[model samples]
Target: MRLDEYVDDIEQDDSVALRKLAEEKSYAVTEYIDDARTRFDETLTDDTLVGSTAPSVFVGRSSYPNVSAGVLAPVGDENDAEAYATTGEWYQQGFSIDDVFERRTGLLNSTRRSNVDVYDVWDGFVGTQREVALADDPVDIELGLDDRPGFDLDGPLEDIAAPRGPRAFAESARVTENPSVPRAIEKTLSDDDWRAEGAITYLYRRGFDVYDINNVLSVGALGEAENRRLVPTRWSITAVDDTVGQYLRGTIRNAPPIDRTLVWHTSYMGNDYWVVAAPGDWEFELLELKAPGSIWNPDPDGQLYMAADNEGYDGRSGYVEETSGAYYAARLGVLEALADRDRQAKVFVVRYATEAYWAPVGVWQIRESVRDAFDGEPAVAETFHDAVRQLVPQLPVSMAALRRKSTMAAGVQADLSAFGAGGDSSRSR
Candidate 1:
């Protein structure tokens, strides 16, 4: 069967879709695992390089006022490891989740317990921070580990097969050379009064990508006052995505809306996404459909699991409790495309997770997939409901079920009711 025919099968039932998709394309989840395990085994006796192209700083969640600050870099040739750090390259190269894990598993995590707010110039943290935050290119470093670290296959279902990197307490670390620093980063680092948020926005506007900004923030390189502390790596990822997303949103606030409803779809690592942009205010919603046998919903006989979250024109001030990091990541991608067209629209994103998306490759896939989806020819419709009707046959759930979970869809229903009551509507088609 063709791809389109397979997609048509998805709307009927999960088992049918899975069976058809499997028959259409041979998916070797075990092959991916074997490749990652082979690469991970090779790293056991090899010396690794951290921060080759870009350094990764990790802040531990424990110890409260004092947390563990660590730097991570892959174990490989200096040039190769450096290239591995660039996520854009990975995306462009079409690297799979297993490929990403093989590289990440080779990283050496060297850590030390320190006060979160400590940024004294004479301390070791300062040296590591400067090297990671200011370096314009990859910086090679040597680490003295207290002991050899072990690997584990334990993680969330989305990332279960990916081997966790080995970690050890750092006895000492020394940079091989003075890293080439960007003047913009140098200036930002010099200014202690600049808040992290402002620095992130400035760097992003200045053409520095999120990966660079994330390194800076993770190492406690930004923020005002003497209270600047290392942000946990997980937290920093979401923070940078959110910060940049907000910046893009601000630019499109007054921009003209798109001429019509546009729907774009793409899939990566077994997660399928549909991005729908309609003519209206800047409302947004994300609806996720997890197949019964998928990782999040592991019951073979269970119904599909659906979850959604949304926000109005102003966006949400608090965290997106439903989607977590994925919300910000996907939102950033959508906002970026809208900003590029100099247009604003109410966006409704629908995601379908099949059993094939068995392993998590982080939210970067979502961000990039959504970004790329907009590049395709979109399916256009005259109304929001019409667009949903058009898309329903391609999705697993019914329109009524989607409407019940999606605030934006609910809003559409309310709009229809209001129009019926008053006979005319102010919302533009």
Candidate 2:
């Protein structure tokens, strides 16, 4: 399906707004640290901190079984601490990249060294981390840092989990208040025999968002007791997305195909998405065109870096490499819409990353942006080829380049001369 709704194609320059917002917030980094220092003085007694956690946790993958695990707590305001945790709501609130950074930088990651295997113990720092993960809301905690918290904003942003703030070695941590655990999560945790996949799907069915599920799973809170282990935050995010997406795909496997070729378009942050749902059996492909100067492709004069990954009706046999976590993220978006409608389709997603996408904010943006796309009216086309023709000009890369990268687009046997070239067809990096 092609997007011909020229009226809907017009979008405000969110990039300009984001850049301006970044400039305005750039000077606040030092102020943020200074304010945190003041709060530290007021709260810290004998190197111990009395604060509220955002109910956020992080697990690093730098080492094998050995890793850095932490509890994330806001430095300033304790109220509205729940918002500090990662969620789809951030997208709904229309957060800019700078806004994301501001919120993340405000949190102090109080961490300690621990093994990934945390299935039995439930009283120390790791146990407290699990409690925070399982909670329904932010919890007040008493944290003792070995030394003053470290602040360093100069680094590459995380590609999967959202960017983290400063870090500190935690001497001890204890939850001061009872955290309300949802019955579904409580049940899942109680059943040591319940497999992780079933537990995850159950929580999803009970209305727990993926973000919440990811947090819980990352802390080794799920799975069969003996098999449960702490999962790196980055890997867990993709694992949940892929797992949930597979479950969703199953629900629509036998459903009827969409009656018409439908096209939806939406942009968030600096990424543009054109989702095409053509009438056919279940097949999905995600094609990405990264602008030369975009964050992932830094050379201003470099060719656009194009990447793609697809799955047939039976689903993928192995992990996707080209698009990495984004493949699962984008696929989940399409599968969700399909499952909701009780219909399947041959879906193709075109993600164009403009230079305005100056930083990485994680894969949640992809999942949410594509989910939000279905909320708007879709353009209908008589055939799939027509949709591609209409979308050719709006894309950053030429039809030749897209064809080379996209499996679905490559299947089109149309004459190139009739389609007409638009973008540069140079070799993509």
Error of 2 at 82 (Å): 0.7
Best by TM-score: 2
Lowest lDDT sum, 10 consecutive residues, model 1, at: 420-429
Local accuracy by lDDT, each model:
0.70, 0.83
Residue runs of model 2 more than 4 Å from their true location after superposition: 7-9, 19-48, 154-162, 418-420, 427-429
Candidate 2: tens digits of C-alpha lDDT, residues 280-344: 99999999989876678867788888889999999999999899999999998898889989999
Model 1 Cα displacement at 327 (Å)? 0.9
TM-score, one value per model: 0.83, 0.93
lDDT of 2: 0.83
TM-score (C-alpha, index-matched) for candidate 2:
0.93
> Which predicted model would earn the best lDDT?
2
